[model samples]
Target: MIKSGETNSRSFPGITISTDLVITGGGLSGVCCAITAARQGMKVVLVQDRPVLGGNSSSEVRLWILGATSHMGNNNRWAREGGLVDEILVENTWRNPEGNPVIFDMVLLDKVKKEPNITLLLNTAVYAVEKKDAATIRSLKAFCSQNQKEYILTAPLFCDASGDGVVGFLSGAAFRMGAESRDEFDEKFAPSATYGELLGHTLYFYSKDTGKPVTFIPPEFALKDITKIPRFKTFNAKDFGCRLWWVEYGGRLDTVHDTEEIKWELWKVIYGVWDYIKNSGNFPEADTLTLEWVGAIPGKRESRRFEGDYIMRQQDIIEQRTHEDAVAFGGWSVDLHPADGVFSEKPGCNQWHSKGIYQVPYRSLYSRNISNLFLAGRIISASHVAFASTRVMATAAYVSQAVGVAAAICKEERLLPADIIHEGYIGALQQRLLKTGQYIPGLVLEDKQDLVQLATIAASSELVLTGFPGKPLLKPLTLSVAQMLPLPEGAVAPVVFHAEATADTTLQLELRISSKPGNYTPDVTLATRTIPLHPGRNCITLQFDAVLEKAGYAFITFIKNPLVALHFTEKRVTGILSVFNSVNKAVSNYGKQTPPEDIGMEAFEFWCPQRRPEGHNIDLKYQQGIRLFQAESIRNGTDRPAGQPNAWVADWNDPQPALTLTWQQPQLISYIDLVMDTDFDHPMESVLMSHPESVMPFCIRHYRIKDAAGNVLAEKRNNYQTHNRLEFATPVTTDTLIIEVEHPSEQVPAALFAVRCY
Candidate 1:
């Protein structure tokens, strides 16, 4: 009915189009892939079978976008997914704090639409694939039911982000469905024997209070008795949205072929459950509640996992293995659910947490059989045990960004996906990703375009003893408050404290070591220091003669003094904490508590209870100029290494911090790239918790460049965002270059990730 063409044509019944990259499935992963590729100047076709984007995260399914943070539970600290995914989370937080699914849809749609090189094809399903050979795909045939038209799209590269691995399935890419035997991948957590069963699918519903009584009429398909359901005992009428992930089915059957049947079964369960809550006389609270929204499409958990060059195993995650070609990282626990889903009598799911974050290699992103086929989302190469953690939407989105960036590099270099590593292009891809704000653990950006790298580092002042201060010094306490400080295992060193007094006062400090880090009070007092404080700021030093046998907390406390106050800041560090206690109680046991009036109940708690903040470091070091030179920042790269600080911090007092470069011989430069810190300490998550700053206030708001003679070379004012690349109209030859930066706010230190010149 249609003739083949290069662009959309109405002459034929069907439409034909072409692009450099064809991304199937409009889920978070696919959307990120398309955006990343398009932003890099590649023409991209983003095809989604549904009317909207966000896949499970859309209003249709309403699943929260969870990544490494894992709902802020477990011990996965500071593990939020960065890059394009962070942008979406931040924008959603700013626009929709109530976690409204409708607004989230707009955020994703707006992001894709803003890309000039991206051609969005919503409600278009790619059903057929045209393969050039056994390893290459030539084109794809997609049918858009909404428009009642078919589209034949051709592209050099294809990414199958479809949750079901539809593209890879049609292309005959080798893939595994369901679980694999433990012997297959030597994964200890995997089942002893292989099974065709999968995690399952789920449908969610939202309910709201109408203020007045509401009646519910059951449909013919709804179940009459709720007693048949095993989970009814735990069900509550108030549970809705993602809180009801337990209402699931279809794990025992084919997730794709049996989708309709699964949806019908889930529908019955949802209505039946609603009926029980409304008319069953069991829940009186539901009389004033009504159903607001329900999902028509089931949110699938597992389907076909395509085969790639490397198959990620559970050991890689549990052991925290690092790969040389790792492109992304994931920290979600290995969460596996029974194939029987909600029907099973056992607990819904089992979770195994990792020691920390784990790495995902690039080799696991592209197909091993279909050379030209790239995969993202839950379909990426991983054993079933490993997929449990990587299958999360946020992790999938991060993977998609990696694939998108790699695809752009492939197109630019005229190479295949596998050839990227073979030809040493992986570094370039990593650098580009870092510059674009994709955080790859253990990797650093080494940009050469930064002219500041040649400059001698100097600063007006440097805060050498910089650490997290738990909370601001707002109120003075007459009672002593003990704080817990975690220390590395080994011989203990003298701890220092920075304090100030309005008048001369006697201060007594004690260091007590606790065997358990969670203990609210220490059992043994290892050392003590009694010093007379001066009126102005003073540094008190305490020495401990004991050695810590293991990594534990050193409970330090300053005796009650109403006239003296300890300086504190709101800035939070990862492992430090400010502890608080009940004024009249002493902690009898570690985390256990006695009655409120009990005098022996010692409770050391966070400065702001249930909140996270940094500890105040008494030994603050001050230096003149930036701590690290421009060369260190540019050469070290922008990827913030885990457990290590990679950013160059300037003096907080320097109103106009600047970096200058001077050379004996003049050099020609035209391009300048700058990477600034965007408050990595704040974890960017979906809806419930979002960072307040879309653009960190500490970043340079205004800046200008000049030559040795003080002639303005280029200037930019009202700057925002973390990454900035400026191009000069003409190359300038100069022996000296000075970069002046105006802070967005006074007293806040400037943090530079990298600055490069070319």
Candidate 2:
């Protein structure tokens, strides 16, 4: 018989750790919980399995953050999720213009380091959970790389934010994995019976655009009837090679259970597919193509889910059940992969809703058997069908945020997992979510005196502004009648602010000065020269010497009235900017072959749809205008030039970056024009904020910038490489303004792009 182990003092021999909450798994869910808990004045300890903070969405998986609000909506920003998610987006958009993975790691590290309330332990793995009693887990044993020793973390509350639900499994919390038969939960998507069958896995890779001849080949495992099995036809590579490849199998096989085995299959398929294309002569450019990424770590879509008080079933999602205890919402359809262990072209694999979003109750996130433990992410208690939809990372982030807040509430009230329902705390929890800037569709607000008071205070204290470069002034810059935003009450809110403000109202902002740290030279230094500021609305101007010998970027921060709006404008035609990522590795889009007459020129088109694309502007007044893609130089009129290759590249010289915009003049600065030029595609990266008038000249000192409605803007741009001049035309009236340039990239040169005010 296996006897229960005791937590001896020797377990935590040399650790000086302290925190009110300990969150495991630094993935989307874990990080969200950490950020939320830390913001609420709770000491937080966050642990992760990987070296980086983003788990499946990191370079490890190469998966982008997908959400319902992506590319559309008033907050059509890179990522609408706020707090930690927002922080990550801002860094990706500006600092890593090339979408460098290293930049993501650094950004996460910097944010965690800056927060005094957060204690981060990297390269750590949790091995065991020691509980003092059936209701409470006393400590957790973790192996750390830096110390090369084991340590125990003791906290009042614990969260299984790990996407794998490791803590729940180790703590003996009831959990389920794989598929459930259709009749089990009456889920239309469920299998005949809940079985251990799992979704197929993948190892995603990318190719650079290099104009060259390519040939296609057949796979060694080429089954003539492969498409008949439902997987082969998903990807359109007739020769079985050289395309967007996805090779998967039943992840439950023991012989193939090892991570290394899974990784091997992925690689084998990747090369096999390439070989087929090359041999078949179907992919002429495959010969010159470069692999930008091999298979990232195998991303397991569905796994063990911890059983909670209320299990989310397929019926809950299909019927769009509105639970009285709903704490979060998801709009994604019930997307389920084939269970037959092969890629299927079956028409009925995924499900979508026509109207309202699916609601997730609080009881579905915490363990019913464990009192002190709560779970989030894909592993939250849900039937197999439900897991398929909620498995996406964006949805996971919201769930994680909810977990963090609920944990805080549990600690403060000294309540058990079951007690939360009786206290009517779910509504309070929903309010906290709204305050954080995440949108939970169909959230019905319950009346709470304290919540109303807090919301009122937040609304009143917020700054609302108009025009770019809104800064403090020696006199009030009168707001033009056209520049004012429609306010509900007499109280105004800050429309767009630049910097993160401190308790004392100090603004902190970062500038991109150099690509590499060693580029620093004392002779060419940057010194801040501040301008005068007054009340109402004003602009602060900062002047510095642009004497850097090499190309790079820098950061700046200043105070301003919150009501003004500073629109950032860019005109880039052919290069990487802070905004966009190239679809392939080439600056220009080139197909392998074309008709004989159009031998060297490749035909392409560019469409912006409106004047200002969503997330391109903060005020939401302008949508992008459709423009045609015009090539300055081409080998031929309609075919790719013989030597011109297509590749995924990033250009940092584009006008758009993580720029903090404040109003310089309210009336004159009505609309902004952004233009760009790139070799392959146009990528623009910038942050847009809206706030009340009182919050002018968004503070830049504290490394935080928000819009008038408290929405935090975050962006991620991968299109890099290239050099081209871009232009931005923003109307301005007031004198003196603060413009903070934001650039996030590993290889940004000296300030080659500048702003010209007309």
* CA RMSD per model (angstroms): 8.2, 20.7
Worst 10 residues of 1 by lDDT: 583-592
Steric overlap count per candidate: 28, 174
| TM-score top scorer | 1
Clashes of 2: 174
- Per-residue lDDT tens digits for candidate 2, residues 1-758, read 88866765544335746568889988767777788788777788898867788776666665555443322211111223443454455445556645555555676667677778888888889989999898678888888876776768998788888877778888889988777666676655465423335665666666555566433344565343333444433443332211232355444543124656666666666665555444445555467665555655776666687888888886675456678877666644455555433444443243332122467788988888888888878888888778766777767777788877777777788776557787777777776665444445444223232111121111111111122222222221111111111112121222233222122232222222322321111112244433333323333332333344433222222223243333332322111112211121111111111213311111221111111331122111111211111111110111110011111112234343233333333323332211111111111211112111111011111212233444432221332222111222543343222222333322221121112222
Q: How do the residues 1-758 of candidate 1 rate in per-residue lDDT, one tens digit apiece?
A: 98766876554269889899999999999999999899888999999999999999998888888877665443343466777887677567656756778888999999999899999999898989998988899999999888788999998899999999999999999999978876787766674322235888999998999999999998999877776777788888878887788787888889999999999999998999999899989899999999988899999999999888899988888667779888888977677777777777766766665545788999999999898899999999999999988999999999999999999999999988888888999888888887777877677666566555565544433333334324445335454656555555666666555677889888887776643332223556777778898987777655656676666556666777887777655543222334443321111112322223321112232111222332232222122211232235444654342333345555555666676777667879887777655443344444423344555555667888888899998888866655677888999898877778765654355656666677
lDDT value for model 1:
0.73
> Which regions of candidate 1 fall more than 4 Å away from where they truly are?
1-12, 192-196, 280-285, 466-493, 497-568, 572-635, 657-672, 681-683, 688-720, 726-748
lDDT at position 41, candidate 1: 89
Q: Could you tell me the lDDT of residue 221 within candidate 1?
A: 98
